[model samples]
Target: MSPTILAAILSVGVSAIATEVDSPQTQASIAVPANPDNETFAPLTPIAQIPDNSGDSSDKILEQINHYSNEPNALDQVTNVSQLRDVSPGDWAYEALRSLVERYGCIAGYPDGTYRGNRAMTRYEFAAGLNACLQQIERLIAGTNGVDGGDLETLQRLIQEFEAELATLGARVDNLEGRVAFLEDNQFSTTTKLSGEVIFGLAGVAAGEDVNGDDIDNVTIFGHRTRLELNTSFTGEDVLRTRLQAEGLGSLTEQTITPEGDLFFAGATDSDVVVDALLYDFPLGENTRVVLDANAGASDDFASTVNPFLDGDGGSGALSRFGTRHSIYYYLDGAGIGINHAFGDKLELSAGYLASEAADPGDDTGIFNGPYGALAQILFKPSDRLNIGLTYIHAYNRDTDTGSQLSNFRSFTEDAIGNAVPTSSNSYGVELSWQLSDRFALGGWVGYTQTTTLSTLGGQIDRGDLDIWNWAVSLAFPDLGKEGNVAGILVGMEPKVTDSSVNIPGIDTEDEDTSLHIEAFYQYQLTDNIAITPGIIWLTAPDHDNDNEDIVIGAIRTTFSF
Candidate 1:
């Protein structure tokens, strides 16, 4: 009846309006170059310019046809196609009927193109259209429920499963959002201090065995101890300050490894890794601040020749088992740079890079090797009373090539085992500290390492693999006396966790055992620019058989700061 209904009834309205009405040539003929970037490309041809007739139809049918006509391709109905035979209105009718034939295959074309539109009274053609409609209706009915009549049921089920999974994922995201909000609402802050002590001591002992049935006077030169440490900060920003110290440098040969063992040094020897000072900070929005003295020239652990690694309290005043720390070297020289920053005080971050040069070893050049190293650290203070920090260090030493000159220090009979063993190594450390009050504090540390070679032979031979581990704990008590006096005690033990052996045949690869460390200290003000410090330490490590092995030393030190 109407143009729109006629097209849909034949199903030709959908296809002809889409392709024939939206022609590129028609649009280009009326085009102005206004919105070129988003313009759609379409086929350009004179046949695509046909106009649609404005006729009446059922409102639904008319609306659908107009919508299809506005799409990309619509107007290229009859003239847009190329054919061997001439096409007329009858050809358009035949092509419209072909859409149903292609999908359902229910009808066959006549032997000649006559009576196709006007005389379609044949039962066979009518039956074919009925068959096509019945087939499409049956397929639609089967697809109405959860399943399909064809094998496409599997595809439908898969789509449903995907939708369920998407809903579950959305629920999980909502739960995580609630948890994150709760954590951000309850965040708090913590503060902590970073401090440590390194002591080096030297004292005389005898050749006979002590009451403990161990060697008393195998007297040897040793680095009684060394310590590096930092002060704690918890203020929601980056802050860095450090005080490094080394003591007991002048008195090296003072302890016995065995009863009659030869002396490690004829007398006092040189110290290698001395103390240096670095102070750095970041003031709110200001740049990082640093105050370092390559040569502070103070005295004692912080200075040179005037104050050695030891503090002169060696004999009867040695520290008990309750107050000792690991040993370190004094008179040693090194230079370093430090950085400190804080992201709001709870997460404190600090790092340092240090390099220590070789000190001139006196007569026994082989014993005093050249060592270089780097150090870095990060600390976290989540509350005002507790602090945690981690430290990383790397060190390297050149092979001491002149072994013959230091024969008196340590003796070795090479079952071909002794030689120059240059090594490079890294150490990692973690510390936890707590301040109980203004007058008391406690802390501990654990560190592991696969360090440089602990030499056996002279500087000529090397045994590459030597691993080590270190650990400790300590407590400090302050304000024991008047305003100027202070006291503290510390005790810790570090046991070796490695089979202390090198690749050598017929040589006894002694099990590297753990060493026990202890220290005690008391400080009194002597003057405005000076303080007197008396301290003692005891160190013990077992032999390969787990026997008692120990060394005891003491010292007195004076410090000045400006």
Candidate 2:
């Protein structure tokens, strides 16, 4: 008989004998040996006191069992009883354990060859051990080898009991496979994403006069603009962005001769699609990144403008161009390269160069020889609520007008001789914004430009050198009417000809006055991806002389984005 069977029979007999001796009804029928030492039988410990041998201690053994179970045909190389460190001749269950290891080939020991036998066993450990033994029994049965009939019957019963649970697990796995297949079939491009936006604007003007001093009869107009962007990434870290845009919006500056700067989204006069911008940016290291603009716009390659409340593209914040950022940002408008380096999250430096005629290769019009604008800015975020930027721009033969009323002053100086003369200028500006609280924010900017005409239009006609100054303060209330809503008011001087010395021979020409530009706007987010903004711009003294009627430009803008 196997040692396991022997131990089981002996254990059952001892328990019965002990129970009978302790029973009140049968105690008198039992007798104690006169001299216990003289008996040949060995004393047996209680079954509860016999150490449990299958729980955490069997973890290493279970791992090997799982491996062999997964590959049932794998060869079992362990064959000797002495291979295990803890299994020895003196062990009470050594014979049974050895038989299981050497004959059935189901048992495994720890990496160090130790067989821990005193640890408690859990039900899962018992199941794993039984499964290994069953596989060995099945091999013997299939080969018509010496396999016990009772062992085969027990294995068959256990398999039948677990049939329902096994079926449920298989069903769950099949469901997961279906879900994965569906996702793989319906997914979009792996490396590219698309986004788009459309804007509709209704605008009108009132109480504005022309340069001829006649009351300007401005008509109300409606316009629309649309944009679609595709963002592609190859390395997962770098991005290539391409944008397509179409617009039928008339120039906001076209209604008035005074050069009240253009709207932020006003450009195309026809509803023709064009490539608005294309840019590629990649990281150089942890803190630096380089940007290449195939067709860059003014704001494409700059760091934070420090005025988040009024910087959206006429969809959020203020609707006018001047209200978005300082005019110096408008100096660049074409292809360029930019570099930005961050000093932690609180500070950053950005620099870039852009040429208006970058694609042209004619005499004075190429990327290198054409009218080019170079900009450098240092941005600081002292706190989560405060941002500041110090900017400097140097442009050669570039137009300094940005549709704001101040642009009129700059344009007037350039057109002094009945022809526009190219000018070179160095502009310096400081912008700051502070979110004082959850509901309110304050922002402002001060800009100065020193311009020198480059044309040799003779002595008296030469406009010589000019100095322009512009500044504004803005007050904004976030979530004013509802969540995702904003209201803002801006008041500042338009670029003014603070000092100009045009040597017109006998006539001394200079602008001695500055105009005030006041604007107010409210943006209401109608949905997660849609917004409506109504705004009004009031220019006091459209001309430095204050002779022109106060200009009021009002517009209602609607935007949809996805």
Question: Which candidate number maximizes TM-score?
Answer: 2
Compute the lDDT for candidate 2.
Answer: 0.66
lDDT of 1 at 535: 61
What TM-score would every model get versus the actual structure?
0.41, 0.68
RMSD of each: 27.6, 16.0
Predicted candidate 1 versus true structure: per-residue lDDT over 1-562, tens digit per residue: 1122222233321121111222232310000111113332222221123232223233533343334323331111222222212223344344443443343322322223212232212111221223233444456456753222332342233224233322333444466578868867864423434454444333343233342355765453334334455544556464444555554443322233221111111222343444445444345355333323243211112211110111222211123321222211111225444455566767655544433442335433222245544445566777877777766666565211111111111122231335434456666767667777877777666666554455645544345554545555666655557555566665555334354435445544444444455566776656554556666555554221235545555545444433
lDDT of 1 at 164: 31
Q: Where is model 1 more than 4 Å wrong at Cα?
A: 1-249, 257-287, 290-333, 358-371, 398-419, 452-464, 494-497, 505-513, 525-532, 541-550, 556-562
10 residues in a row with least lDDT, candidate 2: 14-23
Cα lDDT tens digits for candidate 2, 1-562: 1223222222322111110111112211101112213222232222224343333333454443333334222122246758866666766555545555555655554445554454343323233334434556666668856666554554454445433323333443466589878877986677898899999988878677754467767788888899999999999899998999999788756667655544677767798999988999899999999888888556545566778899985557777777888877877778888899999989999999988889997898989898888989998989999999999999887755553332333355455545455678899999999999999999999999887877655543665677777899999999997999999999987677677664554533445555678889888999999999988988876755566677788888899999
Q: State the number of backbone clashes in model 2.
A: 7
The lDDT values for all models are 0.38, 0.66
